[model samples]
Target: MTKKTKSLVVVMAVTAMMLAACSGNGNNNGEQATAKPEATGNTNGNAGADKQEEPVTIKVLAQFGRADLTENEKAFFQKVNEALNIDFQLVIPPSSGYAEQLQLTLISGDVPDVVFFPSEQDEMFINAVRDGAVIPINSYLENSENLKNYSYEHSWEALKTMRDDNIYGVPRTSITRNDGFMVRKDWLDKLSIEIPADNEVTLDQFNEILRAFTFDDPDQDGKQDTYGVGSYVDANKVLLPVLVSELGHYGWQKSTDGSYPFMLPEYDAQSDVYKNILLYTQKLYAEGILDPDSPLNDSAAASERFKQGVTGVIRGFAGHVNAQEKVLKEIDPQAELTYLFVKGPEGKVQGTGYGTGIWGVWAVTAESEHPEKAIQAFDYMLSEEGWDYLYNGIEGVDYKLVNNEKVYNPDISRGIATSIMRRHNAPEFFLDPTKFTKEELDRVSPWVDKAVATVVTSMDKGYVPPAAREPQYMDYKLTWDELTTKIMLGDLPIDQLDKARADWYKNGGEQYLKEMNEYIQSLEN
Candidate 1:
């Protein structure tokens, strides 16, 4: 039998065994095998009067992007302590080494009370659940309306898929927004290139603009130094933003075959969409319109190149336009940016979707003395008063209310405030009117709105197939990276992608498809 058929057979056999086991155990209701501990103290409120008398110390291990906490971050923690009446022993390692630190912590059997996992699909997290190192928070989640209501349903479903149908973590919510190409409006005006009225450009128009930007001296610098586009390689492949305008999809697409409901559009058997994207990119590279250093650049390097005026166009986040413009203007006062919505060959203007609306997850460890307090702390972060502090920071310290309008303190650092604890995935939080002046809002709002409106989410977003974690799958990913990069750089012919696709099936791709579809089917049933 083919690998795909074998995978389906294995899935069916496993499902049958699971059914038989449930029938024999008289526990077919899909409940946890071990009885979960009842959450202690008041579940609705933060820290109750009785609990405040004897403060509970909850240790929290989280990922902080920076090396150390800023003064505002310290104050934010102090505020949380006063409100919650919980002594939070925070273990904030730098984000660069956090995964390694987390692995070490798990291996040492010294896991914190509340652990923050950067990814829900982390193998360590899976093993921790299997080893009973992390406790299921379903009982606590049932009582915490703020936690449950604010978090996306898909996030809970994703966590449930990891272990039985039990939520093991509190989702650190993130707003699902799109990113698109930000072009130099100054350059466009200098070259007298008129974009479409709706800001969406056709593929042919896009190519011409790139040529103009590269060859027509759009910067008016009298130098042939600038490229048309700036991009970086992520995971040894060209960044998605650079190709999404052509491909129309980010990662996975709903399969034409019902047996395997999801397929990676890049390796899809029915179409040459991915190959066409590579050829387009190759043409740009050959014509010197695409950045030469793109294969060597990371996200930071690519952004820097754009900011320093090395390139006229680069992929940018919708919400970060104002900040990016500020940086660009610092170098050249006349520099201006505008977002572009490129109409794909399929006649669609689209941007990639962020799956599950979750950036990270917070799980309570079984070693905790007060799992209930940890849950309460997380729930509090989602509350109005708590979210206000997390999002806006201390009212007087971070911002002052003047005529019922928030006036932010310019000196205070608000970098780590909203993300240090948990986040609520509200678009209003990111696009807060109070944070920007009228001029900035008028300039940035349209792009943000456009991006949000054009997002195309994947069909199999939150589901992780079992075969994905296999060594063969990882090997296939490496092979994919190498082959795609080489093809884009013109080192290999376009037809080589066919070999990569075939290699993918040989190396766990067939099983990956079967397992993901089965999981998706189970959800539907």
Candidate 2:
């Protein structure tokens, strides 16, 4: 064997040994085995006793957002056992350390029966498939009605693109919705600026409003303390709202040619979209229209500034408007917020679209003795009975139904109850009108309904190519972020963007683009 193959074998052996040493009876948590009722025999005089089949035990390695499951979650699992006749042995590590733990578990050569992958493009997931650790679920999916029906079509397409046109995972679905800018309607009225009809504004009109909010003293405070907009860097370290607007889409831009079918809008050779984004941000910063501390601010801080009435506009989900307005009204009772959807250069309203509408995926491992049963457990979660338990929690314990309305128990905490899996096929799945009174719905539905109705979903929302995870590619991204931030803050000239673009190609971007396009072509085929 070659030296590389020998080395890999040795590493695998060591990982297996380590995993064996760490694992004890395959239960990560010190919970007891799930309880089952005794099977009753026939009371009549029968020749033989009736035997009941034992519940299949499926070991699951999932990531929980919190430290551990709550009592309610444990109860939920019991309900699953009663209905599906399956025992779920869940091994959830801390979410912060889950990625590393997952890598270790996969390399150990003794994987869980069912594993949750946060991203379909996760390197370990791809490697596991290449090594035959994970099995394709296309055949099983054909029979799983709830799983197929509840999940988005794009989610299946995304999974097919991951490797060899095979569906390997059941998607944990999320609502496909876009957030836009929310401005203070009271401030607009105060400035005598007429609110745009249909809550839509042209880019020029939007800029004019920003200038007015900044210089015209819309808040009517004697001092020049207010700014036009609150801004902050997203997880990727890019300034948001403006970035989303300037790019006209999220992630990759679909290309016309077969050779380069998908292009990162920021790195497009033919367009200045990215450069213009930086220039516009710099102008906002120089003119004192954007929050001065934006670079150092996170989402929470920016949102807090908006609530404190320090900024007139902030980016937010439509559902959050009611809460934000409540907070703002505490300071100024007249404060009112409304959603704003601006027309992009193409003369259509644009917002960042979440790709495939999947938050995570659940894959049955090849090591599973009952792969079909494992998938059945997931399908059960999407069923009306299971989803009701997941979404609303135990009917009596978490909430009570009175006059066909759910009145939640104030003491119970079901924070992110559906973290393990979600089923958000429609806006109602997210907003859940049943949970709100008519007055509450009246306050929220206008903004949320409009946001959903007018949203222009991106062409490519959740396509993460394998090349995107490479070390060299990651380094280039960091450099790009740093350069973009510097230019926007005027620490570096806008011309430095050229250098950043050139550095991207030199640092494996050319290869990244080639691989991404190839994958896109594969999806087309």
Judged by lDDT, which candidate is best? Answer: 1
Local accuracy of candidate 2 as per-residue lDDT tens digits, 391-480: 778877677889997787766565544666666554544554334666867766766666666554554546665677889989878988
TM-score of each prediction: 0.81, 0.80
After aligning candidate 1 to the native by TM-score, how far in Å is the CA of 25 from where it should be?
56
Q: What TM-score number comes out for model 2?
A: 0.80
Error of 1 at 7 (Å): 46
Give me the displacement of residue 343 in model 2, in angstroms. Answer: 2.2
Model 2 clashing residue pairs (backbone): 355-462
Q: How many Å off is the CA of 242 in candidate 1?
A: 2.5
Position 164, candidate 1: lDDT = 71
Which ranges in model 1 have alpha carbons more than 4 Å from their true place? Answer: 1-52, 65-85, 93-111, 196-198, 237-241, 257-259, 345-348, 354-356, 421-424, 431-435, 462-464, 469-473
